[model samples]
Target: MAEASLLAASIAVLVGTVAILVNRVRTPAWVRDAQLTLNASAVTSLLLLVCGALLVALVLAFGIFLLATRHGVVGRAMVCLAATGIAHLGVTVRRH
Candidate 1:
């Protein structure tokens, strides 16, 4: 579980970095005062991407650990759920 959490945290950091780059690329000048919309979108996207990555990574790590210890059902479920979350994030990123 602890290892899982660490993996999740790493994923979040990676996603956050990507988000920052995306924002930098999309944001434009001269709309500074009313750039609230862009700002909000960037923040929300960043958060969502990071959270999704974290959840997926954590579940995946947990599932792998369980498998290593020969815990079947629990391990499988975690892996499935993690894959689902990761897939969702992949779709979201592609859409944007």
Candidate 2:
């Protein structure tokens, strides 16, 4: 179970990293941001946050699709749910 959890997390991180690279790590308006600061560190942090959120959302949606198609494991579905929940908490805290 631990290994499965780690594998899921590792894949998520890899996907997020690839997304960041593909976007050239630019702070784009693909996601709405109310924060007006455009400093270098802020831009990088926002990029990371956006990519992480997208990754979490994708994983959660994929799990739901799988279940709907009768191709999902309950454990993996639970893992995806927990991942999104944890990610939401982290993003909420960091954004504030």
Candidate 3:
């Protein structure tokens, strides 16, 4: 599930990045406005991608931790949630 989420997120971010790059070369005001929209979309997609990647990283880390000593579901869950929140916050900050 985590891998699937990460894949989807990365694809979305990649698409958004491409769209932004395409829009950036335009010349008109209306076209520039449209590019701004693309920028917002790219930023949002990037945030989701970052969060998903972090979650995958956390899952791997927890898997290792489980092999070491005690199993901890709470810590892993916290890591995932924190990664998501931080990604969202980063997007919000970047937007403003």
Candidate 4:
């Protein structure tokens, strides 16, 4: 269980790092516009909003996964949930 959790966290970090790199290489139009037009405070608030939405989405995805899998693997599910939170925090920190 500990190994599974560690693996999930590692994968999440890798995914988050790749996402950040990709985003840096090719920013979306809306994000670019927001960065350009918004002040620091506004941008921070927007980031928070985006993070919140992402967290909700992650929770919903995990919930659906649990339902589909019949909740047979609680450890794996919990690891995934933790990974999602960690990845979100990583991206948020990178942005800041």
> In model 1, which runs have C-alpha deviations exceeding 4 angstroms?
1-40
Residue pairs with clashing backbones, model 4: none
lDDT of 2 by residue, 1-96 (tens): 865565577568645745554454244552235233423376676776677677777767776776687654643644455464555546444444
Give one digit per residue, the lDDT tens place, for model 3 in 1-96.
Answer: 775565456556645654554454344675556447747777675676666667657655665565455444434444444444444444434444
lDDT comparison, 2 vs 4, better candidate = 4
Error of 3 at 17 (Å): 25
Best by lDDT: 1
Which of the predicted structures, 1 or 4, would earn the higher TM-score when compared with the native? 1
Q: Please write out the lDDT profile of model 4 over residues 1-96, one tens digit for every residue.
A: 865565567567757766775576366774566455444686676787677767756765775676578663554555456555656555445454
Kindly provide the TM-score of model 1 when superposed on the true structure, using C-alpha atoms: 0.56
Query: Which pairs, if any, clash in model 3?
Result: none
Winning candidate number (TM-score): 1
How high is the lDDT of residue 93 in model 1? 69
Between the candidate structures 2 and 3, which one is better when assessed by TM-score?
2
**Per-residue error at 3 for model 3, in Å?**
21
Q: Arrange candidates by TM-score, descending.
A: 1, 2, 4, 3
- Using Cα atoms with residue i matched to residue i, what is each candidate's TM-score against the true structure? 0.56, 0.45, 0.32, 0.35
lDDT per model, in order? Answer: 0.67, 0.56, 0.53, 0.60
Candidate order, lDDT descending = 1, 4, 2, 3
